[model samples]
Target: MNKAVFPLLLLSFSSLFPAHGSGNETAALHRRYASAATEMHRVQVAMDAINAKLICRGCKIDVVDEIFSTDFRLKDQNSLGYDGKYSEAVYFDPPKDLNQTNAAPERALSYRGWYLAVKFDKNGELIDYYLTNIHK
Candidate 1:
């Protein structure tokens, strides 16, 4: 009887301590998250570069006009039956080279048209702009 009981106890203890699977699933998930974060950061850097170039070229009237015009069109498309006119405003903040640390010139511009607002950083090249009318 004692021998039988001892064998059962040993079996229970061994079952309680299962073998490890080397954490393959956790490692895979971590790798995927890291890759996604890296991709996002790369995209942000590219955009920043584009914005800086646009700012360095000086503010052109055609570019500003096009951005505002597109904003108006989007607002009109999403407008209600009311007769209110949509307005677009552009804000520009140029990066200052005060300390001369050779930092890339920062060009931050935001265009708010109707209910849509678009923002670009210094490194973003002004290739395309998107606006959505979210006015209720």
Candidate 2:
């Protein structure tokens, strides 16, 4: 979370208290959560929520494959996964059924000149995120 957003969100928090009496709970709740969420984060969160609703493991894996589709490609989802060894497959192939390790390969990307490695589960769901930059 960005520390800068906290103060703004906290300012919006006070508006939520009056929502129950006015029968605008949904709107208020939306305001509460949406006040600080970026446009990109909303898309990512909605994607993850829908992905979680997939019942079958194969269905989930299928979503992983679709990650490379034009829609996702427009969102820059084609970042390659790496596992230190840099197998050609990791660089060239889509992120599905990673065989290198028990855990999924880290999907590496960059932002603001810093490198990031996003970890994932076997099913290709995001586990956590870690970023590092080479500094002198």
Runs in model 2 deviating more than 4 A are: 1-113
Model 1, C-alpha of 131: deviation from truth (Å)? 22
lDDT string for model 2 (1-136, tens) is: 6999998999899544321122243233334334424434433433442334321222232232233121211222344456421111112112244254556566443323232233443444434433333323
Q: How would you encode candidate 1's per-residue C-alpha lDDT over 34-114 as one tens digit per residue?
A: 353443442333243224332122222233333223333334345423433333433222223345454657644343322
Q: Model 2 compared with the native: what TM-score?
A: 0.20
Q: Which ten-residue region of model 2 has the weakest summed lDDT?
A: 84-93
- Model 1 compared with the native: what TM-score? 0.17
True-vs-predicted CA distance for residue 66, candidate 1, Å: 2.6
Please provide TM-scores, in order, for all candidate models, with all chains considered together.
0.17, 0.20
Error of 2 at 74 (Å): 17
